[model samples]
Target: MNTLTVYKLGRVEYEDGLTLMQRFAEARKQELIGDSLLLLEHSPVLTLGRGAKRENVLASDELLASEGVDLYQTNRGGDVTYHGPGQVVGYPIFLLPKERQDVRRYVRDVERCVIDSLAEYGLHAGIIPKWPGVWLGQEGAPDTRKIAAIGIHISRWLTTHGFALNVNTHLPHFNLIVPCGIREAGVTSMKRELGHLVSVPDVEDTLARHFCSVFESERRESGVSVRTVSITVLRGHGPEARVLMVRRIPERGGFWQTITGRVEPGESPEQTAARELKEETGLDVPVRALDYRHAFALGEILPPMLVEETAFVAWCPEGHEVRLSAEHDAHEWVSPNTALERLEYRGLREGVKRAVALRGELTGG
Candidate 1:
């Protein structure tokens, strides 16, 4: 049986998460990594998929901006949909077996993951004919409500952009667009159905476990010695926010990266982040945790190990001079786009984007 690696990134910006999905899909296509699942919540944003129609977005650019929601044009299948704080977005990078490459079956399996998860919460979710996500109430019933949405993209038999389950999502946001281009049915969430606040982490765990079951895969555990910490350094607030990235030494092939280091004995991830920040860039700023955590396999040595990472963000006062450690040769303060382009690793790039989004939330950008 194939083993699936799961990364629970607490909350990420929509576009950053999309870029990470594309990178993972490409890697899976090349057989660089095994099948993986990325579970995250997106900061309030509306995305238009490949088949999306502009007409479905009822709000003007000004309205969306004023409401603090970002709009993005994406390449996933399906129409316009809203993703925000209370939604769980799962992006599965899976290489399909030759006999199981049917797109319809893949989608059905994705829906089954959501259906089975909902069942654990005592909600009977099923599929609506011709629709791609899990729904409630009988088909053809006027009261049917959509609880999950699936939009995917495939390349060389590898899949990306899996599904979004509405847990405690703000329903009013969906009014800004015709979700999945479906006007007949309404949208609902676990919180709505259960008449209580459903924690995102609880739903994430249940969904991930069921996803493995539906795909006939086992979830892999991380090695104890593979713990690490990464930090996203930011300057300024809101639209003016800039991320700090360092270029590794020539011996390391000069790849750009954020502050990263391994945790020492008796040190928490946050403590490691702070120490790494001071050591790498001579910055002593306070660190705050972000909703991001991911693990990746490393090395070709016997019994390959997994590196589990916890991410944090720190504010660098403007004009702070960076003193590079021997580990890095150069450093730069750049916009998220430049950081994303310069960073070699998908995880680091996503970390930078998450930092930018965190700044927006903090400063109300």
Candidate 2:
């Protein structure tokens, strides 16, 4: 059996996640990594697949902007669909090695993973013959609803763009389009059917386990601490100082992380670090890019992205109040030790430790 590394990236911007997905597929193609699962939630956005009809999207650009949603055109096979908070979006980067190259069987296995997992949650999810995703209730019935959406891309025997299962998703967002170009059937979430909020992490964990069962891979854990292809800004100053940490919302994996964001075009890693500091936490502290730089695969095998990161420390000359962005649910100012204990990944904790070690010289303390 093959070993599968499951990467649980909490909440990533749609474009950022998409870029990494493409890279992961390439890695699999080149035999740089083994099979892996990329599980995450995208901020509100509408993705039009290669087969998507423009008419399926009903929302105007003005409305989407006002709602803080993004629009994208993608290469996957499907009609228009919404991916947002409270949804479990999974991308399985699998290579169809020789004997098991049947596309139909592969897709069915993907659906089966979801079906088996949802069953554990007390929802009997299955496929509706003509429909491509997992659905609840009998076919040709008013109560039948799509609980998961699957649209994928396979090229050079590699797979990408897996499935999106609605856990506690905002169903109204589906109203912005004729989901999968079907108008007769409606979409539903676990929350609506179970009459309570479903645990996102629990659902994610279940699905990962099922993937192992269905995909013939051994299970291994991976998550955010394996930060890759980005800049991390550790914000805080010393004298009596504390570093800042932010807790992500439950939908985005509910964990603590430092200020981090992608290095956008025309932006240096140092500039990106400083920008993320201001954008994410409303902080304007001075940023010093560390001499340390390293590259690692995003997770054990995810995006198998060989990320080159530039680390920075934002030293505050004095105390400043924190105003957080929507991505994080909570913020804290704590000692380096406390922050290290609270952080979820070794990658992040190490960054905090580095920041602490260099404080005196960086700030002229």
Candidate 3:
């Protein structure tokens, strides 16, 4: 069975995540990375797919801007949709196996992932005929409301821009647009349907598990053999948190990574994490071990090698200066989602998400 790597990107900007999807889709087309799923949330924003109508966006540019929502027209297959915090967005960067190249079947599989996930929450979700995505209530029923949306762009049998399921999303945000161009239908969320708050991480885990089941792939957890530490540095707590990421110098291939390094002889993973954080960014913050770990097979090796990682999260004040070491040329304090989108590796992206959740638990934020 093929192994599916899932990256939990807590929250990200629409454009940054889109660019990453394009890159991943291209890499999948080239057979570089295996089938991977990106789980994330977007800052308040509305996206217009290829079939989008401007009339669907009910709010004016000024109004949206004032509300701090960014708008973009995308190349996906559906109409206008709103994406924001509390909505779980899944982008599957997959190269369909030869026998499963049918786009409709592929979409149904994606819907199945969401449907099965909702089932775990005691919610029955199904497809509405003539419309893509998973919905609540019976098919063609007037009271049926959309609980999820799927918009995808496929190239050469590879896919990107998958689906969004409303977990704790603010329903009023959908009022700004005619969701998927369905005028009579309403939008509902897990929080509303369940009469309680549903943690995004809980939904994320359920979705990833079901996605793996539906795709006939093995779910490989990150961190298996290699001894290494991945630190997701944040500047604040809870919703106000911003992740700190550094760009490697030209000599190091110039890819972005969270604070990461191999453990030295006799050095504990926690010590290595603290040392790496200070060495990489000149930050001496306390490093706390997160519950997150990841393992991925190294690519392009004659003999396959698995790299294991233990993830950590560190808190620093907002305005703390990040002094880059020789290994890094630049640093940016980005949103947790942006950090996840910017990081090039799946392990680091998932590490950041784990760190964010840990922070929330510690701060009760």
TM-score: which candidate is best? 1
Model 2: per-residue Cα lDDT over 1-365, one tens digit each: 78998887776667667767877787787788788898888878999999899999888889887775778999999888899999999999899778779888888999999999999988998998787899998989989899999999898779999999999999898888899998889999999999999899999999999999987889987654433222344444565668777888899788888877777768877777777888887777767766555433454454354455566777654556778889899987777778878876544655666677787566675
Off by over 4 Å in 1: 222-266, 269-365
The alpha-carbon deviation from the true structure for residue 312 of candidate 3, after best TM-score superposition, in angstroms, is 17
**Model 3, residue 304: C-alpha shift (Å):** 18
What is residue 237's positional error in candidate 1, in angstroms?
Answer: 11
Candidate 1 per-residue lDDT, tens place, 1-365, comes to: 98898877665666557656766676777677898888888878989989999999999999997777888888889999999988999998899898779988999999999999999999999988777688999877999999999999887778889899999999999999998999888999999999999989889889889988988999963233477888999998865778888888989767788889998889999899999999999999899888676655454332334466788999998778989899998888888788888876656766787788888887889
TM, every model = 0.71, 0.67, 0.66
In model 2, pairs of residues that clash are none
- Residue-wise C-alpha lDDT for candidate 3, range 1-365, written one tens digit per residue: 98898877565556657765766676677677788898878878999999999999999999897776789989899999999889999989888889989999999999999999999889988998788778998866788899999999888888889999999998998888999998877899999999999989989999999999999999865423356788888878767788887888888889887788998889998999999988888888899988655444445342224455688988886667888889888888888888877887755776787788788887899
Between candidates 2 and 3, the one scoring higher on TM-score is 2
Error of 2 at 318 (Å): 14
TM-score of 3: 0.66
Shift in Å, residue 108, candidate 1: 1.3
In model 3, the Cα lDDT at residue 233 comes to: 88
- For each candidate, the alpha-carbon lDDT, in order, equals 0.84, 0.80, 0.83
TM-score of 2: 0.67
